[model samples]
Target chain A: MTGVTISGVGITPFESDAERSALELATAASEDALDDAACSLEAVDSVHVGNVLTEALDVQGGLANAFVSAVGLEGVRADRIENTSASGASATHRGVEAVASGASDVAVVVGVEKMSDADTSTVTDAISKLTHGREYVQGITLPSFGGLAAGAYLDRYDAPREALAEVAVKNHENAVDNDIAQFQKEVSVEDALDSPVVADPLRLYDCCPMTDGAAAVVLERESDAEGVHVRSIGSATGTHAVAERPDPIEIESVSRASERTFADANLSRNDVDVACIHDAFTVLELLELEEIGFFERGTAWEATMRGETARDGAFPVNPGGGLKARGHPLGATGLSQVVELVWQLRGDLRGDRQVAGAETGFAVNVAGFGNNSVCTLLEAP
Target chain B: MTRGTRDADGLRVDEAFRCGDCENEWYYTRNRCPDCQSATFSTYRLREGELVAYTTVNVTPPDVRSANVLGLAAFGDVRLIAQMSDDDPEVGDSVRFAGQYELREGGEKRARLTGVDGDG
Candidate 1:
């Protein structure tokens, strides 16, 4: 089996106050990645741009073609992916497939989001539309789902809010070394528990902040590759409305996608060295770990409490911090996850933050409250 | 609500349609069955169910003056997303509707989930 290899990865600093436009952020990352790959714009055959709510947030559309034109890479086959938060991973998967299918020799995938330009209320309303407007989300906010889900998990697992606070504390501590991370200061469990209630049982610290940034990955055939080989990319879709599912606690799409990716790569859960499960909400991290088969059901919090997910633990998760501290710019988040995995697999992380002797790395990018999922597996040579 | 829009004032009724072939039921309006892609459907009423999940949104849209408590209520095989009347709704608490909560005139009017008669 053969898959495209990542030759270069680039990212803009994830922050809440990035003044740059979406196009500017994307072009900068694309150019940086091409430079890192030692390739020219002329060598690129296709462009994939991942963006969410650009038209609503930035008043822009036709993102892919416009990006190629602005970056002086016109006439390349270009496409835009809009799978909400998973847009970046979706675009990367498409880029990898393009090279693997012989449609392009070299492809560039850029995920960007410029959300700081809008008001907080506007941003909140925009995200709510991700669910069914008429029935589920017109008046309801996105964090409402987090609050409801967290409350249920606590009752079902016999866990307390302190368990969720540990995730915020750990990720915040990990972000101290990540220069581009939005929050570099470490927080204590008390600070998280005492934070103002955004939704009952879920404090402000439990949610990922709105962010602005971009990241890029360049994929080429392995014969001309210079980085980690994408062992497999698997995707699956669940019921559109989260409540419609029989089991609200389990995300069937993530499990199915993870299983397919591991199967395609001929690997098992035990073989994975580093993993990045989406942590838009602290409770989501615990559930994703369980749903992805990294841990037994209702036991991920114990692992986190035991320091098993730390950078030096048995299997480090989100060593460069997660969406919790990394800042989630929706579209850019998926690519940022891939960028971190590439760094970990290449031993590019510094200090103890870097995992030792990492051989296999994995990541999952979820979209629109687990309605869709894209799981990618990378192998180190 | 246009022509053929039926209403039951006594009980909260959501017009649902089930696929005649696959028995896939949905509360909202849809052209085809998501499962079997069947066009033919039988319309029915969804009256009452239990709360699957809920939350109180402290920060809401500007139009929503007070904190909006929302709920995901299950009626048979389908779930309805709506503004819930119960200030503190348990996961499995029975929820029925007393009246429509169309607070805004032109805004979207979704279903309302309220504590049933017997359940507190």
Candidate 2:
């Protein structure tokens, strides 16, 4: 709805307990973004906050209000948007609209989460409540969906588990240079296979960790620098209960949203120079790539097997390690994708991690089990 | 079929609810038909299903102690996540609608359109 350009982006380390509080992390990120844009905090017209599991994990609520006060964007319209893991992108979508629709001249959108407060088991169970209550809440964890989907994909394609392993290895290798990445160490296929199994066919390396981090983006109707413009953004919802999907293996929301976003931008998938897809699970990397039409059905994994998605491969994907290696702090992940793309488009990243001559980039953020998804296409001016 | 949440004897497993207006059928219990949003419905019991996909979750959180074996089984018009009784479930297995079995031996059982109960 809104024609917005992102002029500044800020991100914190994915693993640290630094800043101590969600609001503090968010304020710091916002400050960095404003400073990056050479704009004062008072210039922000509105504030949008994205977060999930905050009360359960961070012991806080009304985060948008807290952030506005911290940033001196007081009395401006503020809203907290949540769509599970897609919260960040959803909030970005709202901020973009707020500015584009003449509602706000400049909107400060931030996605922050502090997930380290709770233990792993408690945090895992807390997220289970967001899944299909009829089944998933009982026995199947989110990684179980990855395992089941991996089994189905391998069976459908007659492929081995190596394709999934390749995603973990490649993303980890990419993360090695990402200063803000949680895991700096690269992983190997053997390491992934030999790691303890969380779900059959998916090992420790195949899963993204629960991280604590914050990411911020400054959006305005226009930009002065080599800003990345929001070409198009599309959002859609699939079946909340994944088991009830007509095609259990396909993420229809990602497919539909990606198509709409590209169509909105009047661009085709071939125009994309880079992408940041949600890889919360290793199997997700393949499934999302296939559903989003980057690679044909049953072939994305094959491409990965050949290093097609590596930083130096045919089409670079998740050069900043993705959620798998970058560490997904729930809400921070989606906006973080946009940040990585902004850096790539501006050629701000280092040589090895950057996509060469990247003029356009694509980012996709997915909610629980693909229940909902938001896709954004970004282009450099 | 009824809501499958109760751990006790679940509703009939073989029987599935179909919308009277739109002829849409779904496995899970719902107040309104998802297709036409019609509340009127009829029930049909299917004998068996074709196992589509399955996985075993070995490492889980504290709440889940045992390895979780779950699968998607298609019974005519709809597919549902069912707890697999077999340790190694194969896709396309000719699984009968064995209904929901309680985890405890001789525990009260409710039959929902889940999947085949293991040797129990």
TM-score of each: 0.94, 0.93
* Model 1, residue A337: C-alpha shift (Å): 0.5
Where model 1 places Cα greater than 4 Å from the true spot, the runs are: A136-138, B1-13, B21-24, B103-111, B118-120
Steric clash pairs (candidate 2):
A2-A100, B9-B109, B9-B110, B10-B110, B13-B112
Model 1 per-residue lDDT tens digits across residues A1-381: 356889998999999989888899999999988887888899999999999988877668898988998999968999899998899999999998899999999999999998887999898867777775343333656677777788878888999789999999989888889988999999999999999888777889999999999999999999887788999998999877677677767888899899999999998999999988899989999999999989999999999999999888887888888999999999999999999988888888777878899989999999977889999999874
Interface Cα root-mean-square deviation for all models: 3.9, 2.6
Interface RMSD of 2: 2.6
Of candidate 1 chain A, the 10-residue stretch with the lowest lDDT total is A132-141
Question: Measured against the native two-chain assembly using Cα atoms, what DockQ does each of the candidate structures obtain, in the order listed?
Answer: 0.45, 0.49
**Candidate 1's C-alpha lDDT?**
0.84
Count clashes in each candidate, considering only residues at least 3 apart in sequence or on different chains.
0, 5
* Deviating ranges (above 4 Å) for candidate 2: A16-19, A223-226, B1-15, B42-46, B97-120
